[model samples]
Target: MEHMDSSMDIQHLLMMGMDLYRWTFHDNWSEVVEQYKNNAAIHTMPINNKEDTALHVAANNNNAVAVKQLVDEIKRTTSAVESLKKKNGKGDTALHCAASIGSLQMCMCIIEADPHQGHVLIEERNKDGETPLFLAAAKGHKKVFFYLKDCCVGESIGLCRRTSDGQTVLHCTLYRDHFELAFEIIHKYKEGIVGFVDEKGISPLHILADKPSAFESSSNFRWYNWLAYQCIYVKPLRITSHSKSQQTALRGSTADTENPASNYISEHENVVPKNYWTSYDIFMAFTRFIIWPVWEAFGLEVIKTSRKKKEKHVWCGQILDGLWKHKDVAYVGGRVKAYVMPKPGRETDGPKGDAKQSADGGSQKVTADQDKLQGDAKQSAGVGNQKVTAD
Candidate 1:
């Protein structure tokens, strides 16, 4: 088991692959640890065409135990931080792999393995300029996204929260229909990202508008499902003023700027929930238990779907209100208006239908099309009967 550097040696190693890489790809943690005991270089050796090390394979495969073991083994023989920073062909580090796959355990294992400089992983962008935070949000991994987001502070905040294409995490979350998370991002980083426009000149508001199904007007539900939707109470989401003040204080603190861990605030810290169930909760639970079987038996998932749609609608409104209140409202509003309004030449001439089957049935006159026809007749028929033209 000699360390090889030449291309021929690398090819030979690829042909007769090392035991450590083999065990890692197949997820044999015990053998992987045993191999590390023999040679620590095995952990950092390129394992495949992608140049993925054993640690990269382990992290991508999401073996939390293996990742922890390998991180420890790498720490003893080499700089664990340097090994963690090693990028594959796509320039994705082990942390990026962990974040993309939505493995919170693996992410924590990798990042916390090097706490002093773990924030470096969060800030490191791939070839596409996507930080691990952007990948987490794009993949709809809320916990991993939050963990990576909490690691971002000051300048790293903007770097981690946005991509090279100028798309922010808010845009990704909205495009993925993660309305609740999008709403949280709106309030949390309103000053920086609420009004962000991507390279395509699309804002978060434009993305929200594209999701018509999120609005009540787009939902065509049955009467019963709509009733159930109204009955099913969803607790609205809001960030408390205390949390806002805390965020402000954290941003202003110079000490927190250097240490990403210090900027984290638990999601539950500001909430003081009631210990006992309310009467409404008891009643709702009873009603749900009684009718839940019928609801499921008939495959009437609309109740659940409706609840989700309503929640999305609520969050959408809240997000809009928050953005409207931001200092960049004029900019955001103008961008949204531009996106929503039909371009000068692209506007539809009128409603799609024939003149004979008009909604007013020949009684109404002076419609745009008819006015155009009348104007045409004025040129041809000399304008005398413009007011009395027959159908």
Candidate 2:
């Protein structure tokens, strides 16, 4: 009787494990919690063949609510930190999944739940030696990258260390064409990473060199797109405005103590001229009101995309200029010739051909400037009219 009962218990536990796996996979958080309350082992069981826990599934699914509830349940029943630190088949923690998916809320929940080792968690590398910060940059999650960066304040060197295959976050960022984030990485961490070469003998400079299209000379914008690009204006992220206290103080100081209404009337008059609705002004206002809705519905996104593309080209130039200038001071000059100089048969003139098609003033200047920059860079790097073809 005892032997039979033991076999039955084992069968029942297997059944429970299978059910927990299903619930977690489908994001059935309510059922998962109930199963966990009954058997704490469900917290550690491999939900899928990847060996991911319930937390991993919740995080990968970007279900922050499920993550919070699961974290709380684990804290009451088991070790929350250990549970949160569980890795899947690829050795990714729940935080890794959250960061890769760019779920800021899920990352915050996982880190906050681990009161003891939040810093450790941020620095925890997966099987590929990629920290959450590295994954964030690789996936081009700018906000999440900065957020994880904030978590690692004094450990920028360690945080940006070469991951598996000897590739740093900068290499991946540049290779992925995330020039804006790559610019921030280079600008922020100026030391210890200027000369990093991946296992494929590719440095950040090589990645930048291969991307001719990122430069303005290679951009193939239509005439209308160029017009829209010029007219589109992106608002500055940090705007300076008077604080509430300062506004109040200014109002008090400028007001006529004898009569507040007199000061108000004077200020209002200054804002509105006597001919506020002149023929030209009225015509402009009416036209704007009539066209505003149509523009919003049809033209806003296209113009914004053009503006962003233009900004990216600008950033690409800035990156190349900065990195090239820093070459003499740093150790990035080892393989400059093989990478920066074009091979005899390669597609070096692709940008110039595109430039001929573009009639924009900027495109013409860009072709000339790109040639000058390339020639100057080769001279600076001591190639001296000798080209070495890369394999």
Clashes of each: 0, 0
TM-scores of all candidate predictions against the true structure: 0.69, 0.66
Please identify model 1 stretches exceeding 4 Å from their true place. Answer: 1-16, 240-273, 276-294, 330-391
lDDT of 2 at 286: 75
Predicted structure 1, TM vs. truth: 0.69
Instruction: For each candidate in turn, give its C-alpha RMSD to the true structure in angstroms.
Output: 14.9, 15.3
Cα displacement (angstroms), candidate 1, residue 184, comes to 1.4
TM-score of 2: 0.66
